[model samples]
Target: MVALIATAFVQTGFAQHDHATHQTQSSALLPLYYNIKDALVVGNASLAAAKAGEFVEALKNADAKIVTGANRDGLLEHSGKIAGSKDLKSQREHFAGLSTDMIALAKGSKLSTEPVYQMYCPMKKTSWLSSEKTVKNPYYGSAMLTCGKVVETIK
Candidate 1:
């Protein structure tokens, strides 16, 4: 009878421990998801603007995403490109190829394992602003891709 009591106690303790671990991991991941979504929205706008040659509209798209708090799609990440306005019809035709590459990056294995931008190339003026890009996407200097992982969690 004593042995039975001890065994049950051990089982109870283990179950509680497992629950706590699961909760911890789930909680840790929530912030990552939110951060990734926000970055994608911002990055997408830049991509769109680069193609359209309208930097202002790209910024607007990014701002809109940040303000709307839309997280319906489960955090798209991967070095993806949202869409940019291509000024030339011939060059615009090249974007379809870009879509394939963007999709692959969006669904990359590191979407959760690592950061979309795990580098540290800060702006020349501010040491605290990572909200913008460091190196222009060479393809379009006006288009930026600076958002990164969630450094801090909300709750």
Candidate 2:
């Protein structure tokens, strides 16, 4: 996933975008991943060195899962994308866990999480991605995570 995310980052220069369903398990949905990866590029401007590395690592892992297609308990291994028709549990878990992590990061940054929000819903049984959101991620020292959504899935 790190490879895919890194590749996307290299090409897009730090913006999140759907690079077509790479794995057989993918989504036709608008891949709206948190734009916080750009924040990771902030390069210790606000976050500590360790924190920055941790953030990057977390993002890389998530991206890797999406690209590689893990399993039922995994992100990209088994069968699921933003709009996956199966494995919604892991998808939701992935984003929810990410949300939890982001919230904690925001708290540490002395940001107001109250204004922060995330949209996650199941589509049948597959993956669940973010969509049409307007929450500012005060944690990344920027409002990068203000919009997102996953839209399609393979049956």
* Backbone collision tally, model 2: 17
* Top TM-score model: 1
lDDT of 1 by residue, 1-155 (tens): 99999999999999899766544443333233233224333444444434333322322333222212222121121112223332332222333333233233233322233333322223322111112234322222234444222232111
**Model 1: what TM-score?**
0.29
**What are the per-residue Cα lDDT tens digits for candidate 2 across 27-81?**
2111222332222223222222233334334434443434332221332221123
C-alpha lDDT (0 to 100) for residue 23 of candidate 2: 28
lDDT of 2 at 39: 28
Candidate 1 segments exceeding 4 Å error: 44-155
Off by over 4 Å in 2: 1-86, 110-155
Q: Residue 99 lDDT in model 2?
A: 44
